[model samples]
Target: MTRTIARLALAAAGLALLPGLAQAQKNAPHNDIAAQAEQVFRSSFRADNPKYWMTRLDQDEAMRLCSQYRDNPPPKMRAQIEKAQMATIRYPVEGKLIGDWKEGEKLAAVGTGGHIGFIQPDPPGRLRGGNCYACHQLAKKEVAYGTIGPSLQHFGKLRGNSDEIIKYTYDKIYNSNAFSACTNMPRFGLHSWLTPEQISHIVAFLVDPESPVNKD
Candidate 1:
């Protein structure tokens, strides 16, 4: 009689759990939660921040698609993004793809003036830089470097400073997604953060034989 009662109790417990299990299965996350999370994320930032800083949060087409696809879009969508971004690349009026590598060295090393700060945002008209060392190993002497992107220490040494190399390096700096969609590399020239001439200097930094990236 006790065994029969215990079996009945177990059956009752199982029956009670069925509704909760069903609800759990049906409550999978979707748009509502995503919207809420995004709202919470936005609220974390200061609303009084400068327009330039606030605007950075707004997503462009590529950025929107990248987030939707989790930064791993299929080939068709990836190609579409690259094509659209490539159209935005501009060349200097003088059509120079290479500039003074010396200047590029300065830009690549300086990581200040980022726009992410709120209470103490960068002062207006402050100079920004590629902050390349934040993501890439540019020169061998720089022991402290990020590994998010490949080490470019021997970039020019490995890839000769040919016209093709110069053009590719310049375009990549101007708009990295033009070559690799949803890339972590910033679209320096595309967003006017860096001018075409500035990009050309970075190109020289990457492909110039005399640049520390190559020689040192």
Candidate 2:
């Protein structure tokens, strides 16, 4: 009840500032407003929403640096971030850098799991897939793929699944920030969003000669 009242008051105060927002903002201390904004944000979430001790709201070193630079840090800082992120990557135990593309294809298409909110809580044992197609085009058949990232059709045909390419593909999938700091691509393995074996499977889906990503 108190948090709800505070949020409402904050909203009202914000509206009251609209008439002379320019002058008021000029006079307002940024730190004060920032603190108030943070309170409002915190108050907006339901108590249960932040439960389960999830670290989703917490920022790690890389996330902090990325946010500090607005995702475009200096070249030197970018290199530092990438190197640090690279050190966090772990390979599979059996020395396998590629796995079944069929599994990878399923993972790429699945965008389910890790859901939040009281009405949207994920069910037990629900698979948390990488949902690669959400950001990049893999097979020519999935006409609904997003364009946030470059299309990867014919990836193996163009790059050829060489030993170096296999390693590169695995490393990139495990932790894309190792190659490019602040990249939109998630650090699947580093964050444990996907297992090392899962990443290897994704690598195969992109580099296997017979995979639809190449054949199609």
Candidate 3:
């Protein structure tokens, strides 16, 4: 009878401690939670090129700040972040910021690259693409487009192809955070996911009068 009572007391003690453990987890700092999540994410993935995947996990200053602000940084901080990101933008050497819209159109439809799974690294020579259609609707004929971002249909018609507009568009694509801090748009150029020439092509797709983005 004494042994049974002892076991019952121990069970009660363990049950009493459960709430405190739960509360501790609930009160853990955001960084600690993120660390735990990162650990789990890293353990879940198996990559032959671990360094490629591991480097992706490391966040830059802008990404870190965006996370801290929950993608809504205050006005002053927003300006600071924008300025910092703007400084990172590198224009082309030839002083031309436009490329073939045809290439851009192809790139927009492609949603492959940086993919890792049980299959590991992608096949060789599979070029990375902007995958722009995943977010913004550029071409009016595209039946499938995500609404996470505003529709960019008639983009060139709305915004005239002035030098200022062209530069603004180029910079925005190079590092979207340069224009809007904590934006969901990926910093394509900042991360080298796309080269300056490739970004220029995307800009052309958006601003060129003959591009599908502006076509009726």
RMSD of each: 16.5, 12.6, 15.3
Model 1 TM-score is: 0.79
Task: Give residue 121's lDDT in candidate 1 (0 to 100).
Answer: 68
| TM-score of every model versus the real structure | 0.79, 0.80, 0.78
Q: How accurate locally is residue 127 in candidate 2, as Cα lDDT from 0 to 100?
A: 96
Writing each residue's lDDT as its tens digit, candidate 3 over 60-166 gives 87787677668976676677678889999998878789888888898888888877645566776788999998998989899698888889898888998888989
Cα lDDT tens digits, model 1, 1-216, are 999999999999779756644553354336577678879888888667768777888889888767766777767667767988999999999999999999999999878776567456678777899999998998888888999998999898998989998888988988999999998888999898888998889888889999999998
TM-score, cand. 3:
0.78
Instruction: Evaluate candidate 3 by giving its C-alpha RMSD to the native, one decimal.
Output: 15.3
How high is the CA lDDT of each candidate model? 0.85, 0.84, 0.83
Query: How many pairs of residues in model 1 come into backbone collision?
Result: 0
Candidate 2 per-residue lDDT, tens place, 151-216, comes to: 999999999999999999999888999999998998899888899999888889999999999997
